[model samples]
Target: MHRWMDGVIGALLVLLVLVGALRWVDTTWRPVVVLQSVGPFVVIGLGLLFVGTLLLHRWWMLLPVGVCAAVAWAMALPTFFAHTVPGPANFTVMSANLYYGRANADQVMAAVRAHEVDVLVLTEVTPDVVDRLDTAGLTRLLGHRAGEAHADTFTGTMIYSRLPMTVVSGTANPAIEQTPSLQPEVVLTVDGQQVRLKAAHPMAPIPDQTAQWRAGLTALQRWKGDVPAGDRLVLAGDFNASFGHPGFRQLADGLVDAQRTAGQGWVRTWPVVGRRMPPFVALDHLLSRGLGVVKAGDVAFHGSDHMLVWASYTLR
Candidate 1:
């Protein structure tokens, strides 16, 4: 019994180090990308190491335990130290994925209204729901919007803004038809300056869709790189990739993640479980290149698999 228990503890400690090492080599390979999404679980690895230390009573255990703890802290430091450089918040933006049109529109609207969101982006939008929103007065209420609503697929996406907006790459623009993502680019005159808003929905990085997913990311990268220096840009949506993923990190090269900037990156919004389990991944984001986040967090949306994410940002 003693030998068996010792072996179990030893194996657990080794597994912690192995997982941490795997994360450092984060790749788009199926298993690695999946593991990277749950990178926050490194905390659990630390916990297992702590237990091993208590049970193993071996000097060698301390080495792996310290290594595991270090890795966990390194992964979590950004969430703990996140803060906007220095600025005053001007407006709020929100993003929500409709779970393939299963989300409750009433709940979504309530959250948007409560947050006083100036910009709202929704994915997995269906034409029927678009009609419903219009009938419920959202069309006139929002005033400025863009999207092509489709039915029965997770491809539909829409953007609504209370501010007057000109469709620069979507809505009436024919160029957006070639892109894989349903991202709509719009220019809004905010505080007397032209601010660009983009609603992005990247393809999920699954086995078969990996090529399409990379292409979608490439399109976004090119768009970001092409934006003029004077125009402020904000990108918001369900990226289908976590912050730890290489693709998301690449997307954030020049922009700042609102939640990470506001010290709220630890707040997860996706996979909102129903049976007492809380969310574990942060897949939704509001990223800005010329804005600073004053506040950001997740809001609950009924009947949706993803929680609504909102961010208040200031001109930078």
Candidate 2:
């Protein structure tokens, strides 16, 4: 029994170290799709190490490890609320991904109405749902909306804007069966300035694999060149990769994670309501390179698995 326990402990520690090494390498100069792009591999790895220490009765070692872990987690708390930063342009706009099957569309819609975000981005949106919003008089009620509808599934992607868009990318996902992701893009005037925005909610690795999720990412990535460099960019989505995952690294290469830039700390945005498990890491992110975020916060619950998120940003 002692021998077996030793081997198990050793192996777990080694794996944890390896994951940390990968993340350290990722932070250097590697483009998007590095480990930090998805789930936080460091946190995950350290957690496993702590668990192993506890199980092996390494009380002395566990104490220090526990303290470090607590501090690290404590440092990531700023992202849960919203923040603001001044830039060369307008005051702000916003983005979020509404998982289609979350509790229900009505709850999510109510949040949207209450939040009154300048610009809205939704993923996992179905055409039927969009129709409902349209009928609810979004253009008249909220603002103007542009989105894509798929015959296969009601869910796709969309964007709602208070300002008129000058350029837009998609109200569509990358592509499904020769189709794109159900996301949308809109360009609009905010305070007499034109801002280009992309509201994206890419596929998750769960209920699938890293490879499959990457395929969806590939589609979104391919669209980069089409975006104008002068315009401020906003990319929001529920990318499953934690901070240390390779998949998120790929996408992070081109864009900056709004969470890292503006979020106060390790801001996690998933499973906020009645969560059975602790949110292990940050999943939902609003990112931009040319834009400046003034405020970012997680919307309160709407009976969905994900908490709605919004951020105000200036066009730079």
Candidate 3:
């Protein structure tokens, strides 16, 4: 029985490593192996595997066991620590995937106006929803706004800001043949500085993960780096890539994870259900380049399975 138990635990660990490797390999691979909300399972399973090995007879395997523990611990490093900011001039930035719910958005919009978000970013926005928000007086709540609701739902993304944004450019993706219009980028000016605010929801890693999903990351990075090193930049959305991967590190090359830099806890913002927040795997992020993070947290939740990300920042 003990031998079988050991075998079971060992197999699970091996499975975890393989899953991590696959996540590293590609995004479309997301669906092939993991179906829905796999981040929490991965985090919990790895932790249990490490703990279960302690009672086994083959304790010599402890060396590798320790390595697994350390690796899992490191994967959580980005959001492992919570940060606090000390200041009087505070501005909060929040983002959420609307899921095109007008009624639900009434709650989301009310929350945004009450909080007085400096810049609000949203994706998965439909034409009717946009019109509803317009009629609901979001332009006044935001103090300024830009971008038209898509007529056909090709790209449903928009950024509402209190500082009045100027559309620098929106990338339509010449590389993608299908779903090419979904991801786009925009530039905004706040406090006399141009901040590139990009909202992207790339296709899940299914067919040709690297070429397909990574292409979206590439597009975001292209628009991001378009600005000079001396400007403020904010990249927010569901990056699909979880902990311990190069895909996120690739984006972190010049930007700072806002949750890691200023959050007060492991800011896990996915699978937001029943007012119960889970911190298993960190998705949804508020990242900035050449900007200082002041305040950030899982700011809001409603329709989608993903939570919203909000943070206050200053141009440095």
Error of 3 at 69 (Å): 1.2
Per-residue lDDT tens digits of candidate 3, residues 139-243? 777865544456554356677877757765454544642234444455676666677776656654555554566566666666666667876777776666554
* Superposed model 3: Cα runs more than 4 Å off: 26-40, 56-58, 83-85, 101-103, 151-154, 170-179, 182-186, 206-210, 243-245, 263-267, 271-283
**lDDT of every predicted structure (CA atoms):** 0.75, 0.59, 0.63
Candidate 1 local distance difference test against the native:
0.75
Models 1 onward score TM values of 0.88, 0.70, 0.81
Per-structure clash totals for the candidates: 0, 54, 4
A best-first ranking of the candidates according to their lDDT comes to 1, 3, 2
TM-score of 1: 0.88
Lowest lDDT 10-residue stretch of candidate 1: 172-181
The predicted structure with the larger lDDT, 1 or 2, is 1
Q: Kindly report which residue stretches of model 2 are placed more than 4 angstroms away from their true locations once superposed.
A: 1-12, 19-92, 101-106, 131-137, 150-155, 167-180, 206-209, 272-276
Ranking by TM-score: 1, 3, 2
Model 3 C-alpha lDDT versus the unseen true structure: 0.63
